[model samples]
Target chain A: MTVTLIGGEMLHWSDRPATPALPPVGEITGRTLVAGPHPHDLIASLPAERTTVLLRGLPDAEAVAGLGVTVWAGSLDKVAATPAFDTIVALDGLDRLCSAEAETLDGWDERLAHLLTLLRPGGRLLLRVENLFGVHRLIALPEALGDSEWLVADDRDPHRPAGLAALRERLAVVREYAAYGDALLSREVLADAELSGFVSATIAGALATTGEVLADPAALATRALRHGLALELAPAWVVVTGGAADTPDAVVGAKAVAAADPPRGRTLEDELIAAAQRRDLPAMRALLTAWQKSPAAGVPAAQVIAGSASPAASDLTPLAPAGDPLVALSHFAAAAIRGDIAHLWPAPADEAELTALIAGMTGREVEPADVPPLPSRPAPGAVRELTAERDRLARELAEARAKHEFYEQQIRGRDAELKRVRQINAVLSATAPGKAVLGGLKAGRRAVRAVVKRGRA
Target chain B: MECGVHHANHYYGHSAVLARYCGLDDEAPRIQGYLQHGWNIGDGLAPDHEFVPGVPKFLWSERVRRRAWSLGRRDVYVVGAPWAYLLALEPAAPAEREGTIWYPFHGWEGQHVLGSHDNLIAEIKATEPGPVTVCLYWQEYRDKAVRATYEKAGFRVICHGYRGGWWKDLDPGFLYRQLAELRRHSRVASNRLCSAVFYGTLAGCAPAVYGDPMQLENEKSAFGGQARILREWSDMIGAEVDLETARRVAVAELGADRLLPPAELRRLFGWPAPRSTAAIELTGVLTS
Candidate 1:
């Protein structure tokens, strides 16, 4: 197998001590060729039997002599000429060269189209392009806010004390400059300039086109001229190549070209905004439900809807619990939508419940059929009257029981006392003699008393 | 005899104040007037420990003596946790002394799992002198090892029912007052009793061997008292001894005189008595 790396650091495989050794390829082993502004050591690690080459700066005819190893370099009109190479990695070189080589390069999409022409039928071409809906752009403007020259100059001022007033002045200057500059530049011109530059830098270490320049074409001439001048001021490396004659079957199979290069249709954000503006619950629900299943779909949509001042944001709150992809995505979407606006923000407790619900939602999205109907309200005065009557009855019963227990205890105590008193009376009466018996006893006692007295005297 | 009577009266009065402070109003009167005054109206039983139906004296005098000798005066060193009465006495008495150490052995409820025991051990070592005696009312014998450890560390262990015997004679008011004061005196005392009785008991304070059984035994032994306990307070109004006994017990046991000395009583209870000569002279000098 032969691998070709272009417009990058050399592929010095041998330098990587940690890189695992590749298995032997066929009888001759595999060879690799790297072409870039700087030569790297990765090419040296290839088996001795396998041929290896390093092409740096611009490849000259003498350097390509006798090696049969294809030579490839960055060019606009010469892709067809590089038929000997195994692969071509061109980025907007054609559109850039076709448009009188603007001060800045333009047409990354056209350049990619041109590169495809150079590739052999069934050859692999991997293109890494910036995502149009990437967070980079939104954050990029604010990043540029600090990059204003006035802000830099203010920061450099030695006399100014490091204080909030100075910082505020610098910020104000940056804001003014950005607002004026951004207003002057058309959207198409800015998008094209950004996209062109990004593509060029990725492929040839030069800013060729940008999304901002592509989005606005009216301002394109100025941005293009400025970029062209910059490119003339500083040249960068670019390369292109053709697939080898003996390319592997697997590489051919994996290298299926995209069917169409249509401009990214309404971004997820735009769809969300449109849905929210119309208050189309079904569409909003569909979009959110789709996002819940696949968080990637939800993030952009959430950002767009949350950016606007519509009640749709409130509708999206319920979507937090729809755990399709791991609930993390829903929470992230909710937070991004809510942002920092307190009035617009969901209740924290509700949000917390949403978080837990989202966690529970993980692995599945809530289908419309799953939601239950709302509960019916209870009758108003019935409950109040019932409770009141119950309390009254309970109190009355308790009082009655207490009275009964008191009376019962009193009766028992009195009965025991009466029984004891009766016993005591009987004992006393049994021990006492009658009065008549006492009188009869007194007469007998008198006679005996006289006899006893005479005896005693 | 007059002076002794006067001293006794003063102590009783102070005890009443202490009981009042302790919230043992029932016990306060009994100890203050009845017990201290030795006023036996025949109906006067030993608060709750009534000997017979009418005999208001010690049930088993021999037992009291034996128990007292075994548990009392011989350097009883309470080392578990600080009680209010103990903390109050801590400043007055020598930290190291020989006397009956009466620690309301509530057990390790107050001890922190981390370093509480170690801290207690350190305090005991620092404060106590002579053979340490601990009165354990907790039922768990599994703590025999812990008690044995204390014994090994020169402490003598004495096991008794945590809540029984003379404890029943104690006025709840007095207990509350003493406990509250102890809580105020030392955080350790608050934690000990609170944790032991409240938490540990619920958590099962070392399988009480004698608690329910002892209560049943007491009820069976005192037939009339048992009846009194069963009868409602309203019904027991005519019955001689009722909740009054429990109340009186709380007062007597929790009274200020039982808790503090004459001098401390005068200072703390605000009692009227002959001022000390020094105090009088000092007052006169200040006035002059």
Candidate 2:
């Protein structure tokens, strides 16, 4: 029995005009299960022996039972951790995994190194990826932007005229000019945002598309399964298959469902939103801040509140001041205004006592103290002298610190060099032959002197 | 200028063009050719350069020395081969003074011939009166040979191998004829389909051969043959035949025009422009 993992909305399966004719179940004699969130009756026409497993949220481990082979619908990460199968079919899993997050995926070198380990010696791990070196990424940028922009405008905001204008310009550039021109906009926007301390703004376009595309039940399921198989974060659909002894015949039937029409181009806005939704809070905040600064700015208070609502987002918020003094004051003012003075402070119980207190103050004769504090505003010349003194002190301090550091570094370097030179000198001195020769010469001269003394005696 | 041609492997018939451009053809005895081999420290430093083990070192040394000694002995014997270390150890003073021994500072692997060892580069540089050219093969492996060594030894080094246009036109008919002959001889002998065996036969029988052992290995492996063909072919080619014939046969078999048509090769190799006319010229006139 073979298992076919399908992804995305089942509704689209029935509605799509270009849906190819499903091959008869007789062609697929093995018991086949179609697993995804929206499993339409469209595939129900298959023979009764071929079970169709419709799964939502996390996959059902039991669904893989009674199957000789379990084929992941997407990447190597997409399949729920399961035992090796006789045959695994990955239609376009690897490419989709790579394309989904050109960033964030590491250890791929190690993953590739271990590719053969996952399969039986003879089992083949077939992968299809959009060549990073190919012209496909170059051509698809325009289309992706178009679809993404359309979705963002339709869902997020219809009132922003400038956004509309920008979208229009982007669309025109993408349509009229080459894909390279369209790609330039993404690059420039990313660069400008990075320079402005709003790096997340660049990712917002990709994130927006991710959200809209995953909203489709089938696409989400396909992406989820693919990512599960690839052991990577969920991304756009790409086919993956492995564990087949040679290319399996079962894969041909599964390819039809896996090979759907390529995504209608998404817009830059859609991609940004999708990127934001993917839990890059820093990037999301940066993007939102930039967006607020734009001509089509909004209060975005609701977004802030929603962000704070999440546990992760809450952790990111700045800490409040202890026993907030401003908050306490505001509370007190509100109580007094509401005529609930007794709740905060008892009403002046004794009017006579209060009158006496006021009479005492009047008797004291409130007069300003003769404090020699404000010296009739300093003259311009005096102010300039003070400023010059401050400047001089600051300059001296900076120069002293810089000189100190320079001398310290120089001393350290010289010490290290001195140590090295001393070691080399010691080795040279020990190895020198001059000392031995000098000792021999001294002994010879002493011997000659002893001979002359003996002759004199 | 035009650097497209230099990007290709020397086995692809670029050396002949380089020789022609340098005007070495039919002139004073040119350095016969360059040969490269790598050895670990365990192997003797100066392993036999001659194919025959017992041949005197002076015999090979004489060819380079005699050339240097002639014409008032001013002409230089530029040694680019792996055996330059052995030549450096020779007692000939005249050759030592005039012979510009050029050791490719890069490793013998990949595109760059220079190695990265600082000690080796320094040793090469310390040999005074000899100029060290850092041969950097762009788009190929990084060459650390002379510059890394010479810089360590406090000698200045100059860079080379960047100007391109080194590939020469080759005749396709000659290539096809040679391949066909190789196939026929191998099939007749029922020999295993190894490139080494095929190249060995070509070296003995074909008009010309050009390229390194790696090229022979690639062709043989891709075309489907025994894995040990490289070692076998080297041994066979080294014996009995001179290097000149070996180079000629390699050129005839692996030349760009011969292996691939101009348009196809240009597209495949990412050549800047198609040499359609030049390819046709070589095909129509040179072969005929």
lDDT of 2 by residue, A406-442 (tens): 5566569769988999997667556646456666788
CA deviation > 4 Å runs, candidate 2 = A1-457, B1-200, B203-261, B264-288
The weakest ten consecutive residues by lDDT in model 2 chain A span A175-184
- Kindly report which residue stretches of model 1 are placed more than 4 angstroms away from their true locations once superposed: A1-39, A42-74, A88-105, A131-457, B1-193, B197-204, B207-288
* Alpha carbon lDDT at B19, candidate 2: 29
Q: State the displacement of the C-alpha of residue B232, model 1, in Å, after optimal TM-score superposition.
A: 31
Candidate 2 CAPRI category: incorrect
For model 1, how does the per-residue alpha-carbon lDDT over A1-457 read when each residue is reduced to its tens digit? 2323334322221121111221111112233322221112223333333333433223331233234444443333333344432332211112212222122223444444554554555443322222222222221223354211221212233433233233234222111000111011112222343223221212121122232321222122223333542211112111112232222211111121121221222223334435544533234444544554443433323222221234223322221223333333343333322322111111121233333322222212232223232121111223332354456457546644654565566569769988999997667556645445666688899999999999999
- Model 1 chain B: weakest 10-residue lDDT segment is B279-288
Instruction: Quote each prediction's TM-score.
Output: 0.19, 0.17
Please, what are the lDDT tens digits per residue for candidate 2 over residues B1-288?
111111122332233222222222311111222211111111111232322111111111222323323523221211122122111111122211121212222322333332234444444444424343332223232336434554555543333233222222332122223333333221111112222223323323321111222222223232123344334334323213445544443333222112212222222222223222332211100121
TM match of model 2 to true structure: 0.17
